[model samples]
Target: MPEFDDLRDEPFEPEVLSSEIAFAGAVWDVRDDRVRYGDGEIRRQYVAHTGAVAILALDADGRVLLIQQYRHPIRHRDWELPAGLLDVAGEEPVEAARRELAEEADLVAAHWEPLVSSWTTPGGNDEAIHVFLATGISTAPAAHAREDEEADIRVEWVPLDAAVRAVLDGRMRNGILSIGVLAAAQRLRDRG
Candidate 1:
């Protein structure tokens, strides 16, 4: 094991001079903030989001669950993991992941492990997604009705190796899905 001091995290917190809502939308809010950086304060505009959760659902055969959904911003359909927003008041991130898995894929996972977490767009958005590796999966009693984008999504199970290759080949455009798949692959390899 490495030394404790070497593994310690250095805390660095910046001071926010001021912040205000530049625009408010139904899904997200745009905020303009002035913060102290280095020796001066700079103003930046970014999206304030409620965060999200994603699940990399796997079966006994090791295939991974992927969803094909239409993203209006990109004007195309892209493959992604089962995901949902943390908009429900007082709901935990993991609970959101479970809810998304049931809602989008109609599956329930008996084993769930934290895989990875990342900021979807750190430079422009404060949206962070926490992804989990869910195995020992089975069909749920009743899948929840989807709304909006989720209403038209198609779910499928793909081989882990093939999914990883798709992510490396730029076919998998969703950042959360890519990161989660890669991390899950690495963890699987390490276990073997």
Candidate 2:
């Protein structure tokens, strides 16, 4: 049996007693919160994220779609997988992933599978990101109009081998992108 099978059992979850907005930002909000831990109460400041999704879109030739977009916080453009926030009201994570794929790459997939779920920075934020693997790709019927920083994004398709190299060589440093590409590659390898 896999180690993950043990994780199926429910675990104790800390209950938040009170929370207040410390700072509200365009992308994420900071909150000052108090929670009941195992046997004690604690107060901490953390980011209350809206969560997000990332897509590892693989074409017929095993090339993965990547995007170079300006990240204002880091003050640099990064090569990353197609992704977006789950900020839309009543939208599912997979739905957000599909929307982001269309909006970012203008591509659609006939097949979709869950790849990984992770907390981008659990120590300081509640930002959880779910990644997906999308294959059997084609152009979307209608491309979404980009705005703000999204308008300046550049899209490219790089072979999987090259992407792995980039990840191994520290060139692809985006957390989500690095996680998605490596997991997708490992999944493909495991399938063979």
Candidate 3:
């Protein structure tokens, strides 16, 4: 075996010969691009997104807040963190997390710490998610009106350990939820 340097993702921007919006959807757009590689040109199409934020709201009892919403693409009401797109122009990521927590869970958090960030699906989309560990939790003063899929969201608070188990047991499959729960669990262990 040979020793190696630090393993990390490097930024490489190949020359784009041509780029176009193949489809324009209500929330996101699909982009088709022709890029010049080292020896040849390659064409790729992916979803161009505005990114998003998620919150892992932990209460004093060591439980994490989760929401169940219907995902048309997956055709399942998956359990997930309180999350929302960064579609609001000029809104900061943490602020988006705060707003999402209130809108989805009807909760507000006083203390927040950045837990982790991840690219949802690098091979097919440019959507990145920033997850925060929100503590000092309380009910929001005003409730937000829901619509469509969000109108019937099921909110639950489960123990942090139980959430980790669900992720490991293949019960909870949301990408953001898995990342946030694992990161928060590790952070808590490291703190103790």
Q: Give the alpha carbon lDDT tens digit for every residue of 43-150 in model 1.
A: 999999999999999889989999999999999889999998999999988899998898888899998888999888888998989999999999999978888887
Superposed Cα deviation of residue 81, candidate 2 (Å) = 0.6
Looking at model 3, the pairs that clash are none
- The list of candidate 2 runs beyond 4 A from truth reads 1-10, 38-40
Q: Distance (Å) between predicted and true CA of 108, model 1?
A: 0.7
Q: How does residue 110 of candidate 1 score in lDDT?
A: 96
Q: Write the per-residue lDDT of candidate 2 for residues 1-192, one digit (tens) a residue.
A: 456655653556699999999999987889999999988999999999899999999999999999999998899899999998999999998889999999998999999999999889987998999999999999999988999989989999999889989999998899999999899999999999
Task: Give the per-residue Cα lDDT of candidate 1 at 176.
Answer: 85
Query: Which lDDT values do the candidates have, in the order given?
Result: 0.91, 0.92, 0.96
Top candidate (TM-score): 3
Predicted structure 3, TM vs. truth: 0.96
Residue 192 lDDT (model 2)? 100
Q: Count of backbone clashes for each model?
A: 0, 0, 0
